[model samples]
Target: MSSRQTEVMPNFEQTLLKKRGSALTDGLSFIAYGAQAIANDEFSKCFAPKPRNKVISYLLKGLKAPLSIAGMGIRYFLLLPIRIFILFGASAGFFIALPIVLRLKSERLKRLLFKLYCKAFLWSWGSKIRYHGKKPVLDEPHIFVSNHTSIIDYIVLSSHGFPHATVAQRQGGIIGYFQKNILKLNGSLNFDRSQKNDRSVIAQKMREHVFNTEKSPLLIFPEGTCVNNEYTVLFHKGAFELGAKVAPVAIKYDKSWADAYWHSRTQTFSSQ
Candidate 1:
């Protein structure tokens, strides 16, 4: 090879090696951080198996085990088919009515349909929602921010009332199709973080959406990621940057029934 080719190849190999090394370092750091968190019982409290104790806890577990097994069996054999039926039935109804809803001029009807659809899906998932506090007025131009624990957070919020717009990451497959269509109807924004300047573009759009009186309030999860409900992480300030009244919505899960946390780094949405 020529001298120029030889020099360029070495530089290219060096750059590739550097990137691999950096990735390895990041992976190690993440593992170390997770290990530290687990050691502190932070992870265990949220995700790890139930803590074993010598007396009351063990007795409680022993008592609960048979009931738990029975419950699981009943759920898998009986409730599972019912839930599946409801889910598909609801989805079919939504899509079937969507075309007719679009042809109508009544925004109220559209919003009502959306809310009902969300409620149906949540019900299929065996979600027992206990919404507290006064519901926000649908006409107001406010920023509704909430803590996000799982993929179902949006569904739960939308069931109460449809936001004019919501910020969500672009997704793929059947989920992506539903997300795109639902958000399109609401004039919501979907962003690809991997794209250049996407955040700034979405931010500008959000500002416009918040100030427009004709549009209803926008919903945002400032956390920007799912966290186990036991603790919170630092929130992104983008939601606050918009010149609109920021209403905080607190969501807590009853861990006795189920854990809603989605560890995205280690699990896919479907798996979770």
Candidate 2:
């Protein structure tokens, strides 16, 4: 009985081994077919043409250069007339409004109008003001000193929310007429620098404005005339002797884009 049992066990083990070998062979054949399919798919993609969206992207990139330039040209021609109108309109409106502002006795209204005019004038030129350090004192009268760079410096100072008047030297002709009228309307003082007695007269006038009057602060570009922004000339001593509180002010502007310096020899006031 033991021998017959041993013979049956050997036949059963042999059948199990044959089944396992057949399963392993079938699995390897399936893996080889799958790998071949993957390789063929990747190879086809390498030769395929680019996608429709990619082609359109290249086309738009080629057009961007010319399209951007055309857009800028269109914008300039469209806005040119408006800028010119604003410049002339602001100039005319300034002169027209000056007389009315001057006649008003209210100091508050005068300052408000003058500030508005300065802002409008600067806006027409697309100028931007960047202020630094202490501002002008309003409670008590003080001498406001700054370096002279351009006639536009006064306009920029006027926009500083102070009703201060500027000290200017006398001029002649139509230029002088407009200048005197505008400065006088703002209650600014002008003196003849060529005259020997003018200094005494100016000193007395400044003393009265500082000590006697109850108005805005007095502003003076002590250098007298416009300097090359790089260096300053000697300052006049009239503003210093008033014995009042002195506030030193510095004014700077972007000279690269809109240089306001009017040297008279090279640049005219209107040109600046």
Candidate 3:
């Protein structure tokens, strides 16, 4: 080859290598950002395995496998059917009475029915909620903001008869049905987060709801997503933006019996 061609070939190869190196670096940075987003100490504990005891650790380790298997079998064979029956019975009762409840002229009557349903549903799931502090009077418009750890947060709040409208992400299947029908009846707004304009539209509605005394109080999980019960994340400012009296609600789940934190990435709602 000519001297000029030889020199050009080396330069072209160097340029190709530099481009590959740049692309690889960018890929790694993107991965690092994603890791940082979800890998904080508190968040990581959501999926962390239970710690082993130091006393008789070897004996405990030997029994762990059989114990885990037995636990799974008991849950699947014994508890699963009971849970299904309870949920089905509660849902059936709600839907059967919903139409009649809607027809009632009294808003108070409807709210009473809703509260009863919520209590029954929660009871069926074996939730023992001990509420403290003075209950807010439902006569005025107020915004209730709380840290969200699971879907059960809605029922727990509603069971208290706050008469609050919820702002939440749109879900599908059974949850979607409840959000669309039951929650909508109470002026709750569910939005598709994937849509660019949905947030703006929902924010406007929330402001309007807060201003309108005729509407129920607004209930919001300002964190915009569930955090592990161990730690709280920064909240979205939209709830605070609405000029209204904001009452903060705190919910602590008892993890010894069962974990209430919904690990959305790794577990489905039904599975949880």
All candidates: TM-score: 0.74, 0.66, 0.71
Return the candidate ranking by TM-score, descending.
Answer: 1, 3, 2
Cα lDDT tens digits, model 1, 1-272, are 11231221234435555675567876775576556555654324444323223442333475687776777789899999999999999989988998898899667787878888888989898888888988777455678898888878878888985634678888887668867877668767899989979988998889888888666568898988777776666689878878788888988877664567787777777876
lDDT of 2 by residue, 1-272 (tens): 01222221234435555665677775775576567566644333322322223432343476585775665566477555666677688778776866676686777777887787777777766677788765745566577898887777888888876656877877666568856776676557888867989888878888878774566678888877776564556787766889888888776655443445566655557765
Q: Quick one: best lDDT, which candidate?
A: 3
Model 3, 192-227: lDDT tens digits are 978989988988998888888776677899988877
Ranking of predictions according to lDDT: 3, 1, 2
The 10-residue segment of model 2 with minimum total lDDT is 1-10
RMSD, each candidate, Å? 12.2, 29.8, 11.3
lDDT to native, each model: 0.75, 0.68, 0.75
Candidate 2's TM-score reads 0.66
Residue 136, model 2: lDDT of 49
Off by over 4 Å in 2: 1-80, 95-104, 173-175
Q: What lDDT score goes with residue 41 in model 1?
A: 49
Write out the backbone clash pairs for model 3.
none
Which of the two, 1 or 2, has more TM-score?
1
Looking at model 2, the pairs that clash are none
